[model samples]
Target: MTYSLQTKSIQCPYCGEQIEVIVDCSVNNQEYVEDCSVCCKPIIFSVASFQGEVVSIEAHTEDE
Candidate 1:
């Protein structure tokens, strides 16, 4: 099986900066934490993908 990845832009809840991230579209539902590229703060990610594309995504601060 081939793993699929998609690049997405998100707003950091901590710093309000636009961050770019890679999302794995092979999974249906995913929850993870990634640091903001600009602020270097931990951010929570909730992602959902359908048919090899990301259907939904949510980015949150570490405390939120």
Candidate 2:
């Protein structure tokens, strides 16, 4: 089975630009680095989900 999870839009802490972040794990828990749509800087994203709902979200710089 598959389910679409909720998403939240958050501004980049570095550049203060808005970006859409999807926190879905319908396939599996995922971790990756995606660039800001405005500043183009990389943001490390860690997401966890359970029972089709997001359990946790962590975003930070890779250098940290």
Candidate 3:
């Protein structure tokens, strides 16, 4: 089986700027931190997937 990565645009909670993130569909669950392209603030990313499909993507700040 092969897995394909996906891209999504989300708003930054700190700066309210639109940013793009890549998601790996092969993993069932993943969590990581990435800096905002616009604000340079660390953003926590949470991704949930099942059967090579994405269930949800959540973005949060350091405080939350």
Candidate 4:
């Protein structure tokens, strides 16, 4: 079944800036890194979802 999920607003670990990220749980668990909009530094995000509800969120920097 296809499902639509609301995007989440997260803070960039490097610059502490706000950003919007869309999460799709219907596909599966996901992990990726994106640049901070304000600082241009890389921020890693790890998300887990089950039954269309966010189960866990882990955000960290490369040095962390």
Index of the highest-TM-score prediction: 1
Q: Residue by residue across 1-64, what tens digits does model 1's lDDT show?
A: 9789999998999989887899999999999999898989899999999988999999987677
> What would the TM-scores of all predictions be?
0.94, 0.74, 0.87, 0.75
By lDDT, the best candidate is: 1
lDDT of 2 by residue, 1-64 (tens): 6767787677776698778887666845778888888888999887877777777777777777
> Which clashing pairs does model 4 show?
none
Looking at model 4, which ten-residue stretch has the lowest summed lDDT?
A: 20-29
Residue-level lDDT of model 3, residues 1-64, one tens digit each, is 7876888888998999999988888988999999999999999999998887779989999899
Off by over 4 Å in 2: 1-3
Residue pairs of candidate 3 with colliding backbone atoms: none
Superpose all Cα atoms of candidate 4 onto the true structure and report the RMSD in Å to 1 decimal.
1.9
Off by over 4 Å in 4: 1-3
Q: Kindly list the per-residue Cα lDDT of model 4 for residues 1-64, writing each as its tens digit.
A: 6885868888888777778877777655888887777787888889888878777777789998
Candidate 3: worst 10 consecutive residues by lDDT? 1-10
Score candidate 1 by lDDT: 0.92
